[model samples]
Target: MEYRSQGYKTKKCGQTVLSMITGKSVTEICKLLNKEESTSIIKDLKPFLESNGYDTSYKKVRTFEDIPNNSIVLLEFPDESLNGHFTLKVDNEFYDPSVGVISTYNKETRLPHSYLNFKKNPLKD
Candidate 1:
């Protein structure tokens, strides 16, 4: 699912990850939790996944070496300094919700500081 961040939906990046991982639409998610704000969506994500039998965790990624494709990492963009946004990393490219396209990871764009890698899978596994 391709989601572009706008207005008060600052946490749309996390929403994008959830949408891709769960194959659920934003509208469905909103109805499920009765939440319309991005911050509320993000805050309720972990519990929602947990209740659905998914185990979740966060890992600090200092380098790009150990991270695999389709990994969700929280970071901040050049313009947004205070907020930590989330995006899915596929190969050397990133699918960011804040932006409308996939961006290549390079020196000029550079990775964000203090990344919190988001990971989730089935609890039964």
Candidate 2:
């Protein structure tokens, strides 16, 4: 999967997920969505993806076992000062768009984040 950083956008999590699903660059998505000074809103993202044929749902994953394989997950940090981050899970590997790094989910307690409880995929799946 392509990893796009949130960069200057407040909704980097949403933007990265959209980029992964739509195959669009972050800049292109910003322009396409007319997001000039801000970023895409998480709530607005659902309809857009749904219109494009992705079947999406959301949930707050309280435990490590709640995460599903081969899916894009919003990793929410407990700190309210920082915007939550996003990660993509492909099989056993996890990708962080912020740094474009891939790592294994080895049940590290320091993970410090849980799934945002949001889920979505192509309806045609």
Candidate 3:
């Protein structure tokens, strides 16, 4: 019954998912384990699966060839800070839609931009 919050967690949630994944619940599989948060502690976790989880950081990357000129390459660092700007260089200017740089549309809401919406059968919002 030990749990640490903030950023990462150190706890062992009863009812293991590993055995379930492999189709085997040995009960003794993780009898004396203190698993990290990445593993499922399914019962007592907040916001179970985050639809929009973000984290960034400001890092002084080495003078790699990817650093661009004139324009700034705002990389989403590991610590989730959107306050600073980064300048990465590259042979040619490329557009990376995955990083939320060049998106499909500009929305008024904070997140889940227009391009990120996945359409299924047929339901208009």
Worst 10 residues of 1 by lDDT: 110-119
Candidate number with the higher TM-score (2 or 3): 2
Instruction: Tell me the tens digit of each residue's lDDT in model 1 across 30-68.
Output: 677666655422356666656555665545665555556
TM-score against native, each model: 0.61, 0.65, 0.16
Report every candidate's CA lDDT.
0.56, 0.56, 0.25
Q: Which stretches of candidate 1 lie over 4 Å from their true place?
A: 1-11, 40-42, 90-93, 100-103, 106-110, 113-125
For 1-125, candidate 3 gives per-residue lDDT tens digits of 11111112322222222222222232433442333332322221111212113111222333223243322233333344443222112233323312212322222212220111111112221
The number of clashing residue pairs in each candidate reads 0, 10, 11
lDDT of 2 by residue, 23-104 (tens): 8776776666666333333554555666565665555564555677655565545444355556766555566665565665
- What lDDT score is found at residue 27 in candidate 3? 47
RMSD of each: 4.2, 4.2, 17.7
* Whole-structure CA lDDT of model 1: 0.56
Prediction 1 TM-score vs. true: 0.61
User: How well does candidate 3 match the true structure in TM-score terms?
Assistant: 0.16
Candidate topping TM-score: 2
